[model samples]
Target: MTTLSHSPRHGPTRAVLRLHRVPLWVWTVLVIAGAGGLTWLYALGQEAASYGACGGTGMPECATEMRYWGSEHQSAKLLAWLPCGIAACAGAVLTGRELEHGTATLAWTQSVSPARWLAAKLAVPVVALLGGTTALTLMFRWVWGAGPDGGVNRWNSEYFHAAGSVGPAYVLLGLALGAPAALLTRRTLPAMGLALAGIGLAYHLGDRFRSSLWPASEVRGPWDSALNHVDQLEFGMIMESGERVSGLDCSDQAAPGDLGTCLSDHGAVDFYARIHPTSHYWPIQLVETGIALALAAAAVAAAFWVLRRRLP
Candidate 1:
């Protein structure tokens, strides 16, 4: 009896490796085919023939407009979304399939800590997500090219775009959100459905948040100021204060207003600024990312805690 009680520590890790195999291949194909193709299309379809102040003659107008107002940022936005999309489908398939096919019980019996087991399952798709997203970012930088002064802003740069766009957060959120439903529903199709639905809902919510980030434009005085929507999360302040209307806050300036929230026509601007609460765009990205990822971690923890205690 004592001899028969074998503690096989690597069993769960091996099982996880097996599950990850297919996902790895799938991501490879996607990077080569999907990512590659999209990049080509983006490059080809850029504003080459259209907006050329130089008459599309002297220095390649396509690359010209791309220097300042290129669709590179837009391309990055679309590419960044892939990991989140992959995570949703992968999360649904990850262990949901196991539970559906009645293979989870067998998996659970293997000699492995519950923590390790769950972690192993989580790591594979996450790696794929990180790799694909990183590649797309690099490609975005390359194709978009750097203009005079390198034309690199936090909003457009790989680093800032990664943070601001909330791609990683999206993946984590999907994982967190899908896991609980998977546990409760215990079927691949239903779990997948719930995950997809949840992601769709998150999209709408995020869109609203994105739109709200840029405080409305103000037609104060002679300046018909137009804040670049692309730089919504970048510029510290769009407009300087002292007029009847306001745009954003400035750390360097502003004499300071009341301590608490006050409805000051432009009162909404103050409220929006206060709620946004980012000294700069970078901080806003950081806070948003932190909150999203933190929520995802909490969700995962709750799922495992509940499952472990309730089941065994």
Candidate 2:
């Protein structure tokens, strides 16, 4: 006859095991390295081009390319958001996947409490997410090249740095926000759907409030303002995204994006910049990330409180 003794430590140990099962860090490193390598290759090409183009100036063309590429202030949207999307999506599945695979119960039965299990589940990815994102951000910063004054080219691409600093938060917070949604639904697909919807809605609403959790200033374009924007109609007034219309009646053409606002404007279309005063770069990031995390914390707490007795 054999008797099972409760191993208080098993919960954390199992969690660690599960956390290590996935090689997210490896993929993250490879992605960063690949991106940096691509940047280096681009630099080489620019150097060669500059050599060919410059008559008197040695490497003038290369210098120009370096300025453009190295100044992360000007990366493309795709490059910026790809990592973010990856982090968000990967973390998005945290609890939903566990429930989907019927592993949550198994893990819980094996000496782990619901809270510990959930904590571990969320903690691992967030650590990895933030750490990996920070590393990636540094790499992109270095590779994109910096301005001679050690500043960044803020106009190269709209989403580059925006995606960089905030991407990590989005991914991590997105995951935190996802936990309760997944737990409530207990299905990966539905949970993921809810998570995405929540992210969009949260970002939209946050923008309406001009809260830093969602960066409203980074959007808009060089070809706006000439258009009088107004009356952004949202499905939930959650304010995901709005549009710009040329006519005085601000009800014409609208575009699709998260965190945008339509304003009544008729002037030279300069760019989509906030005419109103805004915070400094670092403070904005801090506030935005902090708010997002706070919201996520509330979400996690709500999920736990609601699901505490429901779990077996």
Candidate 3:
């Protein structure tokens, strides 16, 4: 009898691909949509700029201005939320459903081994997720930086993570997180919900404390139009006595002539603020990306641990 090969070298990987075809397609569409959307918006940016910069103009005169901001906002939201969305799907459909339906168990019995099964399950998606998000991040980064005065604020919560290396890290975190969630819950819907909630909370907390990831630059002087463009974390008056106070009570309510006296009464001698300049963009992105990757690694480890315990 002719000898028949018993084991397929790529069996597990093939099974993962066959089972997760939907997510694969969804991811493919998302990559295309994100790149295409950013491309279209970049083109729109050029058109919007041709309107000749409507500073201080009213609504009607600022149509192009409004359109540009609108496009940017839409783009920002899409880029920002897409990772969390994928994480949820990964948790629910990719991992959770597989375990819930006992397919993982079936695979293990078919000589796949629990570890190799999980590897195939995770590795394929992780590679695709990282590659796709990285490509999108680079595309959007270009869109943000290429045009004159068209760049998104590097410090903006919505745009900051989306336009940098952190974007792919976030996607990887979502994928990694989904693994433990699915392994633990072993149910599709609950795992999806939990994974999404975890990712969303982590994202929000990261945003809330982003300014503190690195030391902020301090600027002290009279408040002027120039300071308006900064990403201010804190701003107030510095008292003559070397005390700082918030500006809640130091506004237009004070009589124009008494403003100096009012500020003086509050012991204000100068204005100071903690801010992040565009120069710090890369540092913040890198630090946060490291944290995201760390979390992702931890999640993947936990997933493997859970799988081993469950299987053995």
Scored by lDDT, the top model is: 3
Return the number of clashes found in candidate 2.
Answer: 9
State the lDDT of candidate 2 residue by residue for 59-102, as single tens digits.
66656645554444444444444544554455447777787888
Name every residue pair that clashes in candidate 2. Answer: 50-62, 69-144, 70-144, 70-145, 73-153, 74-156, 204-239, 212-288, 229-263
Best by TM-score: 3
List residue ranges in candidate 2 displaced over 4 A.
1-20, 23-26, 38-79, 145-164, 203-279
Residue 36 deviation, candidate 3, in Å? 1.9
Per-residue lDDT of model 1, residues 1-312, tens digit only: 346643466666567667678777877887777567546644554444344344444577646555434444455566656566677777777867777787777666755555666676676666767667666656655555432222345454333544343666777777666776677788878887887787767756655565354453322111112222234422222222533333433333333453122223223333222222223565556656676777778868876875686464
Q: List the residue pairs that clash in candidate 3.
A: 239-267
Shift of residue 276 alpha carbon in model 3, Å: 1.8
Note the Cα lDDT for every prediction shown. 0.58, 0.56, 0.77
lDDT of 1 at 189: 81
In order of listing, the candidates' clash counts read: 0, 9, 1
Candidate 2 displacement at residue 162 in angstroms: 4.2
